[model samples]
Target: MADIEIFTGPNCGYCREAKRLLDAGGYAYREHDVSQPDAQALMRARLPRARSIPQIFVDGVHLGGSDDLAARLAQGPL
Candidate 1:
């Protein structure tokens, strides 16, 4: 299985969509709520220039946001 991590904020639709796609693909992931200070700091450390929520990482590689995830999913397995 791949190591998947998602950084999300509260009530984010894109975050929901991203999780849904992962779920549908039977991909297990660790979710970090960026609303929390520690998680926010972690996310920033991983992606310094990210200006949005639902930033995803696969096996420590940045995969960008929800739309990018969708595009990646469309290509094949994560």
Candidate 2:
């Protein structure tokens, strides 16, 4: 299985959708809520240019946000 990590924020629809997609695909993932201080710092350290919630990492590869994740899922299996 791939190592999946998702950075999410409170009340984020995209974050929920991203998690749904992963769940539907039967992928196990670790979710980090940026609402917490530690997760926020970790997200900033990993993606300095990203200015959105629901940032996703697949096996250490940046997969952008929910839309990007959808596109990736459409292409094939992750």
Candidate 3:
């Protein structure tokens, strides 16, 4: 399976939904809450122009936000 990492923030609905889908699929992932000050630089590095929360990465590839992740999931497994 591919490595999955999720960049999230506080009070993010899409982040919760992403987690739900991953959990349902039994996919393990690392979650980073960008709401924290320490994670700001890292989040910026991952998504330069990202203006929203729930940015997800699969094997180092930026898969975009929750809707994008759902679209990818619908297309089938990675």
Compared with the true structure, the alpha-carbon lDDT of candidate 1 equals 0.94
Question: Over the stretch 3-75, how does candidate 1's per-residue lDDT look in tens digits?
Answer: 9999999999999999999999999999999999999999888888888989999999999999999999999
List residue ranges in candidate 3 displaced over 4 A: none
Tell me the tens digit of each residue's lDDT in model 3 across 15-77.
Answer: 999999899888999999897876777999867898898989999999998899889999998
Worst 10 contiguous positions by lDDT, candidate 2: 44-53
- Candidate 3 lDDT (Cα, 0 to 1): 0.89
The TM-score that candidate 2 achieves is: 0.96
Candidate 2's residue-wise lDDT over 1-78, tens digit each?
A: 899999999899999999999999999999999999999999999999889989999999999999999999999989
lDDT of 2 at 59: 96
Superposed model 1: Cα runs more than 4 Å off? none
Model 1, residue 64: what's the lDDT?
Answer: 90
Descending-lDDT candidate ranking? 2, 1, 3
- Model-by-model lDDT, in order? 0.94, 0.96, 0.89
